[model samples]
Target: MARPRKPLLSRERIVDTARALVDAEGLAAVSTRRLAAELGVSGPSLYNHFRTKDQILEAVADSVSAQVDLSMFDAADPRDWRTALHDWAVSYRAALTLHPNIVPVLARGPGRRPAGLRLADAVFGAMVAAGWPPAQATSIGALMRYFIMGSALGSFAGGFVDDETAYDPADYPHLGQAHLLAERQDLIDARAFETGLHALLDGLAAQYEHMAGGEGPGRPAGDASTPAEASPGHP
Candidate 1:
């Protein structure tokens, strides 16, 4: 028999099958046998590309990470840090929302995943270049990841059932409208994300102001001291 013009199996196909399984049925559903069956190949054939299921899962997680838009962090002007961070958070949340099942693996940190490392590096480097101390920059990166991942894990509004009787006004007075929330899950979640994001950035801006004002362990000696100069365009 002639060799198939298109390869029957490859690393990309394996990762794609694994990711699809994760997206549809969660990480527990992914396995070398499951993937091989999905790919219409013998299970051992998968070992030719990935030594273990963990490696395949890592590739799947990295594929989702690669979908995020890190370009904002590469802005020419460091003053765009606030905007960059905001945009990056949105992009990161979007990628996770699509594949919430894989978030647990990603939460373990970049590990040896190249794309994950780049995401972390971009955020950390941008914060430092924007005049933040290295320690704070590290904290900021961690904070953003926590916030974005938490948001993607589940929907706050979606927790309620549309069944109006679920609220039981007397039992949960404050939640008089809780039952209505599930129907508006998307809008509520989006607004909540934006509200939280703005609040976080606003707090950071205040801290930036205080640090650059020379009242605290201000910016390094060679760095600009004035708030306007320290983090231009900060919100």
Candidate 2:
């Protein structure tokens, strides 16, 4: 019997390898030639699976988005909405942080991909299910998505200093003091993420309540909380 030849390359394999490459060496290192070399194939072989680096990047982003467990969020409990959002935000931050180099690509173009759109829909659906109107739910969901992506991109680009290194008592006395008190026991990896997510959900909930004819506790009458208000002491 004639021997069967194995498939030379597949889109899944290409995207997986591309993701690993970006995770290891940043997005700059992901090229068809480099990927082919890593996969023990000829450079032109990669074109059979992905026509260009952008396509490969898109594929990689899709793969990553697929890994997000949308079911982890709870849409039934209004009180638990903040916690659910926190979990989702934390998971998203961790995923992007692990591959910081991909943050730019993710921010720039992945928003329209099927997985990305589906994730957005899921978030919006969750919000609506939790009693928010369609427009408010959509706006809040988009706002949270933007916040998470922007924060991750900023963190990847060194816009954010590590909590340990960011504090300087001489220049930032109050911030330094607060950091010291907050991290005295343990410094959580995604404290900022959790804090931001909670603030966003809290603000959204307040808005929803107000729109539904209830006076909310978090914000003043007729004024929504801004991002600055959401992140009171954050830079």
Candidate 3:
């Protein structure tokens, strides 16, 4: 028989199969044997491309990272920090929402993932170039990761049952209408993300102005007194 135009076993096919498994059945669903079966190849064929299942999962996570838009962080003609950060956060959240199963792996920090590293580098570099102290920039990256990942992990609105009777008015007066949220899950989640994003950027903008004017939290922009315990995360 003639050789197939496309190779039967390739790294791309392996990663794609693994990613589809993760997306459909969570990260635990991906294994070499299963991937090989899905790819119609022997299990040993996978080892030729990936040494272990973890490596395959890493490639899948990095593929999702690569989908996030980083153009706003372009050093050549960068957008203002606030605008760029907001766009990046939205893009990041969108990417994670598509592959929430991988968010846990992505949360493990850049490690040795090239695409993930580029993401962290862009956020930190952009913030520093925008005049934020390095520490604050690090905090911003961490904060964004926490927010975006948390949002992707699950839907707050979807958590509630659509049953109107679920909320007992006597004990939960404030949540009387909470049951309605699940019906509008997508709208509520999206608006909630936007509201949170706006609040974060607005707060950061205020702090940036204060720092630039040498009066933020009793320290100037270049001052090293700001609380900066947080470090950047992977996604």
Measured against the true structure, the TM-scores of the candidates, in listed sequence, are 0.89, 0.72, 0.89
Q: What is the C-alpha lDDT profile of model 3 across 151-185, one tens digit per residue? A: 99899999999888888989898998898898999
lDDT by residue (tens digit), candidate 2, 1-235 = 9899988788878888899998888888988889988899999888877789988998788777766667755444443555666777777776776666777776664455777666776776676566655555555665776887776764322333436557777887766434344433223435566667778777766665676676533334564655443311100
Worst 10-residue lDDT window, candidate 3: 226-235
- lDDT of each structure? 0.83, 0.66, 0.85
Model 1, runs deviating above 4 Å:
1-4, 75-79, 218-235
Between prediction 1 and prediction 3, the one with superior lDDT is: 3
* True-structure Cα RMSD, model 1: 5.8
Error of 2 at 95 (Å): 1.7
Ranking by lDDT: 3, 1, 2
**Residue-wise lDDT of candidate 1 within 1-235, one digit each (tens)?**
9876997899998888899999999988988778888999999988889999999989999999999998877756553888888888888888888899999998888888989988888888888888887766766787788888889888999998988887787889898888889999989999999999999998888888889888875433464444333321111
TM-score of 2: 0.72
Candidate 2 overall Cα lDDT vs. reference? Answer: 0.66
Rank order by TM-score, top first?
Answer: 3, 1, 2
Among these predicted structures, which one has the highest lDDT?
A: 3
Per-residue lDDT of 194 in model 1:
98
Each prediction's number of clashing residue pairs = 0, 0, 0
